[model samples]
Structure formats: structure tokens, C-alpha cells
Target: VIDIFNNFALGICEGQQLDMDFESKTSVSREEYLRMIELKTSVLLKGALQIGAVLGGANEKDIENIGEFGRCLGLAFQLQDDLLDTYGNVDVFGKNIGGDIVAGKKTILTIETISLLGLKAEIFVELLQNKTLSRYTKVNDVIKIYDQVGVKQIAEALIEEYFKRAYDSLMKISVPDERKVVLIEIAQNLMNRQN
Candidate 1:
């Protein structure tokens, strides 16, 4: 428990630092963004699961499985959060959308869009930097570029992939099928949630 808490605390701090660093960067790779999210968000979830498994008298292998499952689920959750910030309905999403674009946050969607757009990404970056532009215009224009490159689809696909990997890890645990049912249902609900 002590070690888990320590690691979790350190991971969050490091992740936050990386996030700040990415803010000034012109371009951030998908891999780098994923790593940042994993450190910032996944580590806490992973540590909790690992600690729970240890308390439950799980073997080392089961603990590892739980960690992997939590890690993947955390990644999926963060991706979904990023998606919601841009694409979700304001009423259901419970917050103003497109905040990421306005803030110029380096989400997976933006990273992929920039990568696909190549040199043309400069135009998108300019839109983000243009202080005179209204919030509506900036967000609308960025979303247009995102839609042009099918970034939402790409993000959704990545989320599905992570969920699948998480499920695979969950299945490797030694628990009986009945014991796993609740977890499976929770995972499904998480994937389908609007907020």
C-alpha cells in the first residue's frame, strides 16, 4: 500500500509536468500523449487495482493482470473524456464542449489530426493561436478540421482497442466467470456513458 501510494503520487506529478511541457510544443506525437495520459491518469487506477488484489490474497500473476486491466481501462477512460470535451452534447456532457481546442490542449484527437494533415497542420495551429477569434469560431473551425480528417472515428477506434485489451487482461485473472460479470458490465457501461 505504501509503495503503491508513493508510485501513484510520483506518476501524477510527472504526468502533470509532461502535460505542461506539451502545451508549448508545436507538435506532440500520439505515443507521447498516450504516455502522458497513462502516467497522469492510469497510474492511480492501476495502483488501486494492484493494491486491492494484494489485499485479496491474489497471486503475483493475478495482481499483474489486474494492473494491466486497470491501465488499459484508464487509458480508454481518458480518451473518452477527451472525446467528450470536443464532441459531446453540452446538456448531457455537463460542460462546455471544445474546451480542449480553445485551450490548445494536446489530446489524442489533435495529435492524430496534426499527423494526418502534415504541413497543413500549421493552419489548424494558427486557428488555435488566434486570440482575436471568437471562441465559437475557433472551436467550430478546429472541429471542422477534425471532422475533415475523421479524428473522432480514429479516437473512437483507439478507445475500442484499449477496451478490448483491458478485457483481455481481465479475462486472464483467475476469478470465476460469475465473479467477473459485474466488472464486465461496468466496463460496458463506462464505454457507453455520455457524460
Candidate 2:
């Protein structure tokens, strides 16, 4: 059990990678983003809860439920990140900021835009890649691609799924209320912030 638990524990990062795939703005679609998020973030979050319950001596059934709960929670956390990266202020981002969505390469928003824009995307990419182009144009052209493809709505939907998944995970855990209180607070405080 511990071995399975360990493998799953590390597997959690897979979902994060999937989310990264979306954010990278490569060539993803809205549905594709969902699949990645579910696999990467949801699975790992679920695995973590199950691992905890197993170590805590919870029953098998409860472990399974807790795993689901964890998955949902993870989804929520991830979605919140997605939102911040898109709409949050660049000033707060600390480093170079445009909300990850602006880069319009492989991010969830980019995927949506590319799907809609089609071949024009090639020209867009060329302009985006141009060393001579100003950063403002790069951002502008990329956002144009997003607008062409309906990225904003698509990203919004994806964000909602992660939040729902988080709630599902929270509901399934078997731990006492006290044990969960801190976790809930963490979810509330950390899930959507830019820091």
C-alpha cells in the first residue's frame, strides 16, 4: 500500500505539468486543457488525500472517498492559479508580468485562440517571435489571437472545473473537523492569490 501510495504521491506533479502544457500556449484546445488538468492536478490531489488516510489508519472506503476529495481540492487550487495568471494585475506578479495568458503561446487561453484562429496563427506566431517587434506588439498580437479563438470564455470554464474538483475533494475527506479547518483556511487564503 505504501508503495502504491508513494508512486501516486509523485504522480501528482503530472497534473501540474498538464496545466503547464495549457499555460505554455503551444497547441492545446479547451477540452484538451480539461483532460490535462484532471489528470495532472486532480489525480495527484486525490492521491495525496488517500495517502494521508492510509497512513492515518482510515478505512479503505474512506481512503477512496478522501482521494476523490483531494482530487477536487487540487483542481480548485489549480484553477485559482489559472485565473490569477490570466486576469490578475501584472504589478503583483513580481517578475515580468502579463498574466501568463498574455504570452499566447501554450497557455490555456492561447490554445483556445489558436483553435479558433487557424492558419492565421502561423503569421501571428511569426510576428510574436520577431526579435524586432516591441514587447507591446507581441502582447497585443498574442491577445488578438486569443480574442480570435474565444480563449477568455474557454479559460473561464476550465477554471470553474478545478474549483468544483476542489470542493468535491474537500467534501470526501474523513478527517475530523479540526484537522480540516486549517486546510480550508489554506484553500481560502492561498488558492487565488498572486503571491
Candidate 3:
């Protein structure tokens, strides 16, 4: 328990540090972004499930499976969050859209767009970094660039991949099939959510 807590705290701190470090850079690779999110977001979910399984007297294998499930789910959730921040309906999502772009956050969409656009990515980055532009205008400009590069499709595919991984992990758990149904439903709902 102590070790889990210690590692969890360390992971969160490391993730935060990486996020801060990435902010100063013009671009971050997909691998670096994934590692950061795994530490910042997924570690908390992984630690929670592992600790719960321990308290519930789960065997080692079950613990491992549940932890995998948590990690994959966390990744999928963050991907969805990135999507929602850009494309979700403001009313349904209950937040301002394109907040990520306005803040110049480096998400899968941004990273992929950067890679795909080659030299053209500079224009998009410039729009994101321009403080003089209105938030609405900046978001619209960025979205236009993303649309041209098919970033939405790419990001959706990646999100689905993570979702499938989460499901596969859940299936490996030793629990009864019925016991897993609720979790499956929850994952589906999260994936389908507009907010």
C-alpha cells in the first residue's frame, strides 16, 4: 500500500513536470505525450484499482488485469476529453469548446496534425500561440487546419484503439462475465458521451 501510494504520487509529479516542460516546446511526439498522460492521468486510475483489489483480497492476476483495465480506460478517457475540448457542443459539454487550442495544449490531434502537415503546421501553431486573436477566431482557424489534415479521423481512430484495449483488459479479469457487464456499459457510455 505504501509503495503504491509512493509510486502514484511520484508518477503524478513526473507527469505534471513533463506537461510543463512540453509547454515551452513547439511540438511533442506522440510517444512523449502518451508517457506523460500515463503518468499524469492513468497512474491515478491504476493506483486506485490496484489498491481496491488489494483491499478486496484479489489475487495477483486479477490485480494485474484490473490495473491494465484502469490504465487503458484512463487513456481512452483522456483522448475523449481532447476530442470534446475541440469538437463537442458547448451546451452539452458544459464547457467552452477549443479550450485546448486556446491554451495551446499539445494533444494527439495537435501532434498528429503537426506530423501530417509538415511545414504547413507552423501556421496552425501560430494561430494557437497568437494572444492577440480572439479565442473564437483562434479556435476556428485551428479547426480549419485540423479539418484539412483529417486530424479528427486520426484522433477518433486512436481513441477507439484505446477503448478496445480497455475492453480486452476487462475481459481478462477472472470475475464472472455478468460482473463485467456494468463496467462494459460504463465504458461504452463514456465513449459515446457528448459532454
TM-score of 1: 0.97
Q: Each model's C-alpha lDDT? A: 0.92, 0.62, 0.90
Question: What pairs collide in candidate 3?
Answer: none
lDDT of 2 by residue, 101-173 (tens): 3344355555555566677767755654566756666666666666666676766676566556655566566
Model 3 lDDT tens row, 14-110: 9999999999998899999989999999889888888988898988998888888888888888888998999999999999999999888999889
Q: What TM-score, to 2 decimals, does candidate 2 have?
A: 0.70
* lDDT measured at residue 178 in model 3 versus the true structure, 0 to 100: 99
Error of 3 at 27 (Å): 1.7
Q: What clash pairs does model 1 have?
A: none
Ranking by lDDT: 1, 3, 2
Q: Give the clash total for candidate 3.
A: 0
Off by over 4 Å in 2: 9-26, 31-44, 99-105, 118-120, 127-131, 147-150, 174-179
Better lDDT candidate (1, 2): 1
Least well predicted 10-residue stretch by lDDT in candidate 3 = 120-129
Q: Which residue ranges in model 1 land beyond 4 Å of their true spot?
A: none
